[model samples]
Target: MAYKALYRTYRPKDFNEVAGQEHITKTFRNALKSGKIAHAYLFSGPRGTGKTSIAKIIAKAVNCLKAPTDNPCNNCDVCRGIDDNTISDVIEIDAASNNSVDQVREIRDKVKYLPGVTKYKVYIIDEVHMLSQGAFNALLKTLEEPPKHVIFILATTEPHKIPATIHSRCQRFDFRGISIPEMTKRLDKIIDEEKIQIDSEAIKVIAESAEGGMRDAISLLDQVVSYSEEAVSIEDVHAIKGTVSNEKILVIAKSIAENDTVKSISLLDELIMDGKEPQRLVDNMIAFYRNMLMFKNVNTDDFEQLIYKNEEFQKLALNLSNNLVFYYIEVLNKALHDMRFTTNAKLYMELAIIKMIDKIEKQEIVFEDTLNDLRSEISSLRSEIKTINTQKPLENVVKNKEDVPESKVDTFSKKIINDSETEEPVVNEHLIKAKEVIVSTLYSKDDIEEEVPNTVEVENKILSSDLTEDNNVKSEEKDIFNTSLQEEKKVDNIVKYKTFDIRFVEDVLNNGDRELKIDMIKKWYDLDRFATVDDKPYTKMITEGRIVAANSKLIIIEYESAAVCNRLMKKDFKEKMKSLINKFYNSNLDYLALPKSVWEEKSQEFIKKWRNGDKDIKLTPIKNSELIEIEEIDDEIEDMTPDSVKEAINIFGSDNVKVKRGEN
Candidate 1:
């Protein structure tokens, strides 16, 4: 006799044999006995949760040699034939492969016939939601009003796709995923029966790796059994799955906490050398950090109730500071997000780990930032990298300065002034030699200029050049200037300012347009601040960045860690940040990849503000459809001339203005 896989050999034969879905099982078993069955039964649930198995159980119980037992007797001729697919009455179809109106019409044609050996004919359609609209429409009426001899059992992982017309006709029985404990217990039984020597930690890993899918767990169990016939351990399973070990994850976390980039990166390399997948490393480490965090703060009365089953890790969580653990978890989570779109998973993970190390080290001497802060900082660091990447070096300084103004202090005018009398730029000893171009360009023309003795005369000539523009030119400029001034005067006196509230954390990460976490943070904090040109707001931080842990009232503006960064900004910053963030949800925000408890330590400021009815107003949640993008703010502030300031005050009000009030 040939060997059968554990999942196949131990497949549930009766409704009672199926695990973790008693609701659906009990409903179906009673339906079989009561003779109140619907013509079409829609079974929906997550994968590996037993929708298909229950369908088979119903098929056998109804067509059993004996008229009515909730449980089928496997030895009976009808049961054995159907179980082996030898019975013509029980037809199990894979709708995924045969999903067409034509295929459904064939079924519609066949329902008129009677059962051959069994009492009733049954059609089991697996992945029924995969069917096209036409296919579903074809089977609608018969599904609602099929003959007494025919039964249709439709199963799918996603029920939302099934047409409402088709869904209304069927009796819906939803199958739920088996819980971790129930899955673990079932796996333990298989291990005992198969005589496979494995430890408890190893069993737990298989269950978690299955992600609530029983079929997946059993299948993995079968594979693990084949990997090593010797005494099996959790470490062996880790090696097989390319998963990182708890010890390695701890070392990396400690390095991050210590701010040791070199050591953290070295450990990352070692894991890669061990054939570990960067994706898996990031995933396992995230779980490890999450569990450690839960252990530190929450009372998970049964520590075993949480995911990881390693005692060493549980013990390690006890010794670590609450802040450090969350920081590393946040770092690894960013790494995992990067892994999804990147083909070079190892490269991205390594880069993410390195970024985290840098942030941790940067914040080492810093204070107050806890584990949550560390996570936020890691995100900022990634944003900074993107900013550096996108900046362009200037090439032609002489050409760029062709548009310079002429005056005592370089003022713009109606005419282009070539007056060269800008008081030599008041160069200081600390400053390097002035060139033709300095601030924006790589080179400057100031280095080649000849000195003049009568500077006041030069200034007068330049002013004359600007003021003496042709009458036609001056007239046009005067009209335009007055209109702008009028608009500014109207804007500066307004009282109310707009603010936005992020209803939930999920909205915070999803920008409708582009994947931009960092830029969103910077813009939210202050409209005056520009995201680093490389990729400030979104790419570097949230898309695949790290958050930092810092100490102080100042959020120490960085590229990543928008969550905390936004919180640290002024109340106005929070509103502005929320508004900017509203654009980031679709890959128009998708690429933009990018929380916490303070044991509720309240501030008196919030109370005072609340009394004034400031805090009582509900926050305006973002709309689902406004577009977002990883874009540079195109405001005129960067080129903030005197006129720009006057306009800003008019539009935003005096309260929104932050000028360097000079003391003359």
Candidate 2:
């Protein structure tokens, strides 16, 4: 005889012989004995759980030499012939291969004929859900009203794919996966009957590796027997399956509990070197941790009931908290899922172990201790600031009294008089330096003139000449004055006629309408105007700041200096700004504040873009034309004037400026 595989050689020939499906087998036997045979039958369940075997057994029982028998006697010629696939009356079809409409139509053509040898003709279709829609429709009519002599048995692992019409027309039996214990009992029987030398532990391992499939368990047993010359041991099973031993898994778990990342990673590497699958290693680790968690939580009496009842597990559970166990399980489960798609499975497994170690270390550092340290640092900072505040005014008063030049006395007196209504006087450092320079120049003017005799002689000659040509000199002076006046008027006209290009205005309006933009700007300005620090308004910090541009969710404000921009960038200030916008507008908006120089540069870029006629332009006509007239006179003056004049403007307002030529 040729060699036959274990699963095929030990195939069930009778309903009673099938393992771990007593619910279905018992019902079938009763149905057979009662002779309540249906024209069509459906058997559905997980793979290798006896759906096909039971289907074959039902065929045999129905066409037995002795009619309507619950158990087919394998001794009978009819049963033997059907079992050997030599019977013409019994047909076994693999629906996966012959799942087409034409094939079903062939079956429909044959159902009308009577049995050739047996009492009844039986057709067993395995994997019936593989049938095409057309094939299913073709079979529907035959299945609903089959001949009295024809019996159809449809078997599938996935019955949900079968149409509801077919399901309703047949007698359905659902089979379940064999339990571990049931599978083990059957393996023990098979081992004894086949005279196989395998220990109980080896049998248990094979049973678990099969995942409740008896055929798989028996096949694994056969492989182990073939691999081992003598008695099959647990080591043989583990080697055949490429699974890590419980002892190795326990060691890994212990290393993880001790937070020894190096040892855990080394053990994992050794297992992979020994040909243990990376995914299997992760699965074992998850199971090991799950067992430990169970041991930690379950009653002591139930410890033996667990699959991993060992001392190492108990010791590890003692060291682990519930939270750590949960985190470990979560990491391993995620790694297991990731292993399927990852090309470098070993690296992923190693990373998951490292993460577990990191989590454990983090849990050891209490949050309260960190918070207390931070509070202490903040308190020390406050004390230092308070000391500095107490001494700053006195130092300032002494410095002011000592540094005041005689020439600056009148200017300081005027400032004091002008600022009487202010709560606190703000001293300008740059102004004091300017006043000192002016006094030094006044004291050295005569010496400078003595040193530059040629320049003085030239001026004297020009003055004498101008005295003689009085009319010409007067007309020249008038021309110079008029030129200055015209320049001033031009500056005023430029300020009054300031306008933004249409493209730039369109970009702003693209974000939102003009009314909405103005409203947002007003709300933001109010927020800044009312913001205070220590009962003093923050408005002082941004004295010359104003919103330069507005869009739906973006508002650009220009500040006088980078110092104010930096202040606004602080986290506390930003949070306050966001809070006010969200509170009043009921919307979140992004704000940007730039120094005057940066704003001018950006505005120039916008104008350049407008000039280029970029295709991205999408313009909305402004309802209020005046809104496009940006009040950018200050920016224009700053850009057009010389650096010295700009600096003077910075020290004093543009409105308080005068220009005069001195007499020789």
Candidate 3:
């Protein structure tokens, strides 16, 4: 071959050659040594973690002529043939392309026979998730109960996509991505063997960028080394990879922290203009801030710090507040990730820049507010100090005076225990001193230690009084309800009518509501309130969007016309809206109040009201009236005590009747 990719050239040939998958490697070795191998095995994890390579190793180990060890002696013809795919016994199947029921049936038929020349027939299926439902079903029984001499090794990146029925039958081993340090060590050894000149920084950059994929890092290193005979520098690596420079990232963060709007915008434009994806640009900025936060609070002495390899980047992190950095990191991380799914990407990018400007603007918080915040922090600190100072029992001993005579207090009797046991004096000196401190600190010398009355009974009395007040309120409501019911009965006898109120309006607000509704309907009908002179409403407070939130005191409605809003404040539209709402929701008792203008935008009008003279008239339109004919109404009535009694029975039905069998 003219040339081979470094990753393929250095493909792991033995268990020892594989990097950073000890969990997978150890299991394979044990399986080989124990000879208790399953007929079908599944290896699943992130891509390039050696799942495919391990499957190949298994194929070779089982078919090796001279050995049963985990490591295959590749010098033998069997191992050589397996590597070359010339061995009749071993078959490597790319499941992704051949995942069909027919293909699976063919394989199932073949696994029934013994190996041609080798000890066992091995079948390796890669990316097995692509197998159809029917294909997996076909493979299920054969895979579960394969011939003793046949081995099935299925590998997939997303094991979750594979049918659970087939997955349950196979011996599953999850391969993991290689750790960075492990990948780095292996890359360094290969660089040495290839005699490639590269700096440690370049190697580190490639390793971290690989994101735990060893083969990826190797491939990256090979690409970087192809064009350079000199040792690679961070700058060179950054140029080739089109990665954000750590210094530039720091400058952007600093500008954001300093509230330098001009610089922040300039930097963003430069990045976007220079081919950085707006989303990726946001991502890098987020990572920059996250690193600053990690450095700000954590003891990095114990951590393997990877992001800011440059000393200058570390200094920038040092200058930023950890809390502020953390806040920015969290917001931008979410924003950057969300930006991918957004339709207006430029708008989202503008939003991210605006956020950075906001952070910078907030850096200089008010001193008084910060002082109040520090009080909480100080309390937390004192609590920590208290916890650390005395883990011993009995922390509180005395508070008043410095000394006490134990002889005068001999009536008190107790013995204290300590983890440190020692002989006590006839009277403990410490207790005497502590007692003296308590007397002076807590009480006056002449103050009597009387048997004071407890306040529990007094509290109970107040509580009972409050409860009685609640009872009175409830009773008042009951009385009102009863009175209302009696009034309702009278109203029922005297008239057929509807009851509603229109209120909670100052005269000014009522005037505003009247004007607002007229203006709204004008817009709804596209008519001019003053005159039909324009396409738009005169009061541009035309309906735009719903009122997102409202309350008893105020209702804030959205409008297309900012000018209308400005005029409303000058003319008190809020008061108007409030009165209108009260009138519609609780109708003005006189029925003179107008219905509220600010109904939920999506809700159809439930009630409509119009002002009649000085009194408002509310109309609840009957959509479909079902009027009863007089004869039909009479037929439903029963025989009664007279025309009046019969009418009452007919009106109230059997419910108002106390009639015995023949009383009527």
lDDT of 3: 0.61
- Best candidate (score: TM-score): 3
lDDT of each: 0.62, 0.70, 0.61
- TM-score between model 2 and native: 0.56
Best by lDDT: 2
Model 1 lDDT tens row, 178-198: 887889889888888888898
lDDT of 3 at 438: 34
Question: Which is the winner by lDDT between candidate 1 and candidate 2?
Answer: 2
Candidate 1: global Cα-lDDT?
0.62
lDDT of 3 by residue, 1-664 (tens): 5898998888888899899889878888888888767888999988888988888888888888865787888889888888787888888888879989999999999888888879999898998998999999999889888889999999998888998898789899887888777888899889889988888877877876787788788888888887666887766766667777667877787777676878887887887788777776777677667667666667664224455456767777765555556667666776777777987665677676676566222322222234456577656544543342254212221111122123222112122122002423222334333444433333333321321111122322323333423556545655676687799889867863221111222222222332334333344322223223442333234233333222234333444443444444432443453344344344331112122232221112211112122223322332212211111123356645677667778888968776556666
Q: What is the lDDT of candidate 2?
A: 0.70
